[model samples]
Structures are given as structure tokens and as C-alpha cells.
Target: QLHNFCSIELGSFYLDIIKDRLYTMPADSIGRRSAQTAMYHLLQALVRWLAPILSFTAEEIWQHAPASDDSIFLQTWYELPELSSAGALNDADWQRIIELRNWVSRELEVVRNKGEIGAALEARVELWLAPADYDLLQKLGEELRFVLITSDAEVYPLTEKPAEVAEEQLGVAIRVVPLEDAKCGRCWHRRADVGQSAEHPQLCGRCITNLGDGEQRHIA
Candidate 1:
């Protein structure tokens, strides 16, 4: 089960989710810090899990881990964070958001494979979603772009499925369009306002925001 967890879930998460945030956000931004904290916690938990079987490797990992723990034997399972039920977005909402993101990702992959876009970041995505789903994603505001790993993402409230879509897939539809704007040298995301600023003409507007106060991301 753990092997499958690592191979499938964590595999998609690290590559498709965390990597985007880490690469784009500034060094000291809250988003980057959040990703780093998640990675650290995951490492500690995994090291504990492997202590009995891969004793030498677990011990080696423990040695270089953040805290000054003497040995793997001296540790307990990593304490998970307390779950919040009263938040604006709950666990169910996040699961739904993941489902929605998967649809966008598949469409982006199709666009990339067609040679119309070099990367997800080179295209803008438009998501047409059921009213509830649209409202749920809009709570993320602009952070939805980061989650989809697209240059820009636009969500529209929708009611009915198109003729080609299956009945079960009624709530979601995605369209990808290649972007022709200048690419940011730092983040590599193409944007129309990339060259608007003379001081740093090659960077996107978001990059400029990150340079000073950093982007405020509540959810992704």
C-alpha cells in the first residue's frame, strides 16, 4: 500500500503540484515555505516508516534530518496536523478540486502532445464547470493557475454538458490555447505584460509582484 502510495499519489503530487509552486514562487514566499514544510514533514514520516526494514538507510536519513535526533529508535511516528472542519474549503472540496484539476491537466497534455504548446506554462486554460464546481474553484482566485500549472486559468460557471461529453462527465470541460506572449526569464511563464516594465522587461507581472511583497496564496 505504501509502495503504491509513493508510486501513484506522491508521484503525481511532487511532479505536478509541488514542483510548480517551488519553481515559481520566490525564495522566502509563503507558498515556497509551505511546500518546504510539507516535504520536511513527509521525509520525517517516511524515515520512521522505513526504520525497521531499511535500518541502515533510515538511520542515515535520520542523521541528516532537520532535528538533532540521536537515532531512529528514539523516535515516534510523525504527528500529523489537526484536521479543520470549519474552514471555508473542507476535505471534500479539495478532493473535488483535484478531480477538476485532473480534467484540465488531461486537456493540457493533449494540447502539448499535438505540438501546439511546448509546456503547460506555454498555454492558457479555460475551464467550464458546473455552478457548484465553478464557485468552489473561484475561492482559490488566481491560485487556480498554479494548481493547473498553466500560464493562466479562467473558470466559467456552467450548467449543461456539451454534446460530445458523456453524461457522467457533465460537470467539467476544458480548453487549452497556446500563448504567444514574451516568456519570463525567471519563471518561464508566458504573459502579455512581460515586457511592459522597462526596469525588468523580461519578467511577467506576477514575477514583479513576487519580487517585492510576494504573491499571497491561500489555497492551491
Candidate 2:
């Protein structure tokens, strides 16, 4: 159970946060900082929690962690924060998002098998949903694209079913198109604005805005 908590639950949660929220947000933005800070603390707690079963490995990780003490075994047992805490995703909301994501993944796989797109990030997705699902899906806003791991996403009310529609059970249809925009050199997200900036010609608009001062620092 502990291994599943660390490897599956925590791992997927962190990956979703990074891909959807952290990477998409401007580096200097408060939202990005808050997300990164939460991830840092979660990882710290995870290392300490795992120390009992993974003593040597956990201690090695703890030793290298900033502000960590002599031994991870000396640390108190990890306690998860309340669900109402900042940056927390409610269980129901996450379940709905996961279902939508799975729908997109199924469609992406169809395209991938035909060698139409190499990666989910390399495709643009169009989502058609029943009128009943529109409001719930709209609640996701722009984050829907990130959840689907696509270069672009467009949501529309379900009309006549197209031959390419992926799933019928959830009243959701997906269409994948190869992303036409050049991929940003820094972040690798395909964006039409990639070469528009004169100063940062190789970067997307988001990367250009975040790369202020251009002074690189190694985190380790």
C-alpha cells in the first residue's frame, strides 16, 4: 500500500500537476511557485515516509535534500495535509478529468497506430460532447488541453457523429490532427508563436516571457 501510494498515486498526481499547471504557467508567476513549492514538500514527506522500508536509499536522498538532517530514520512519520489545502484537487473533480483524459488517450492511440502522430503532444484534439457534459467539461477551461496532453483542444456540442469519433459511451468524440506549429526548443510544446519573437527566435511566447534575464542556474 505504501509503495502504491508513493509510486502510483503520488507519482501520477505530481506528473499531472507538472504537465498541466507548472510547465504551462509562467515561471515567475505565483501559481507556478506555489505548485512547485507544494511538489517540493510532498517529495520531502515521501522520502521520509519511505525511509522505514527503503532505509539506505531514502537516507541517501535525504542527505542530498536541502535543510535535511543527519538521518531520514530520525524524522517523524509523514502526514498528508488536509484535502482543503491549497493546490489540492478534489476526488470527484479528478475522477471526471481522468475519464476525459482516458477518452482522449484512446483516440490518440488510434492515430498513433497509423503513424499519423508520434506523441500525444504532437497532436491537436477536437472534443465533441453531449449538451449535458458541456458545462462540466467547460469547467476545466484551457486546462483541458493539458489534461489531454495535446498541442491544442477544441470542445463543441455533440452533433452528427463523425466517422472518426472515438468513444460513444460517454457521449464524447475525439479527433486528432498532427500539430502543424514548430515545437519550442526550450519546452518542446508545439506553438504557432514559436518564431514570432525577434529576441528569442527559437522559443515560444511563453518561454520567451519566462526566460527573463536568461541567467541559468543549476538547481542541484
Residue-wise lDDT of candidate 1 within 1-220, one digit each (tens)?
7777677557764546677567767888898899888788888888889899889989998999997468998988889676556657876987787787777778878878899998899999877788899889888888788777888998876654445633237767777889998899988888888999899998888888888878777766
Candidate 2 local Cα displacement, residue 21, angstroms = 6.2
How close is every model to the real structure, measured as TM-score? 0.86, 0.78
Taking the candidates one at a time, how many backbone clashes does each contain?
Answer: 0, 0
Measured with C-alpha atoms, the lDDT of residue 70 in candidate 1 is 86
TM-score of 1: 0.86
- The digit string of per-residue lDDT tens for model 2 on 1-220 reads 8878666555654465455446545666665666677777887888977877888999899998878887888888767665554644467756666677777788889889999889888988887888756666676677666666677788888885576665547688777889889998876779899999888889887677666532221110
Local error of candidate 1 at residue 171 (angstroms) = 2.1
Q: After superposition, how far is residue 157 of candidate 2 from its true place, in Å?
A: 2.7
Q: Identify the candidate with maximal lDDT.
A: 1
Candidate 1 least-lDDT 10 residues: 159-168
lDDT of 2 at 155: 84
Query: Which stretches in model 1 have alpha-carbon errors above 4 Å?
Result: 83-85, 160-168
